[model samples]
Target: MSVDINNYNPTRVLVGVPYVNTVFHFIVGGGGTTLNLTDQISNDNSIGFGKGVAWIASDQAAILANIYTSTFSSWLSSQIWVYTQLPSTSLASTPTAIIPNSQQPIPSSISSELINIVSTPSGLVVLDVSGGILFI
Candidate 1:
């Protein structure tokens, strides 16, 4: 399933999905000049925010770690994994460093640099910071 926040105006937006015994996935999509996840009218906008998990903070470290562990068994797991693609050129400029917001312990076996990021004709980009790229 997908969620479109096109031209949606709100003071604050929050989306929560409760825990389930079965596998579950949530996806959010937004692009184009007319679509946006936030606006001047809102105090804050949160996407895929969760509670009562292994982590408690909304910072990048916790988020990434949770994603890494959940998606790939562990941050440095050798198994191949795939994640949502992002627009490589969507940002105003290339990011200098892709460090997490908070400092957390990551396995030394894990590589720190982004291995590959490819742009697609559909205006989407795939990023693989874990290691090699796995197209889906």
Candidate 2:
């Protein structure tokens, strides 16, 4: 249903069968800066992937503010930029998740990168726009 990563290791390789209709939320710790969603392969040592959301430092606040104001258009626009501008070096592939049209709240003590995914009748909806600095 929900998973919380406290000390997410950037070096650790995450390998799994592609999921469908699943939502991933990478919550940031109080002292955390930003979450890097790079894919790592143990054998190849090639640090590159193309599927996940990496929230930058200020993105948490920016997204929250826009959502609070009920500005879905602006929020989606900004997200499009943020998702696409991610760097390609040693970075994971673009996320196959969807950004909810509404705001989903988490504890104030913690920040998070929410990723909603749905793949049943349709294909994966990976958000690949252009903007925001990818936290590598």
Clash counts for all predictions: 0, 12
How high is each candidate's TM-score?
Answer: 0.18, 0.17
User: What are the Cα lDDT values of the candidates?
Assistant: 0.23, 0.26
lDDT (Cα, tens digit) per residue for candidate 1, span 12-107:
122222121111222233432232332111112122122111111111001111123333334332111122231221211122222332443234
The TM-score between candidate 1 and the true structure equals 0.18
Candidate 1 stretches greater than 4 Å from native: 1-103, 115-136
Off by over 4 Å in 2: 1-6, 10-76, 80-89, 101-136
What is the model-wide C-alpha lDDT for candidate 2? 0.26
> Alpha carbon lDDT of residue 22, candidate 2?
22
- What does the lDDT come to for candidate 1? 0.23
True-structure RMSD, every candidate: 15.6, 16.8
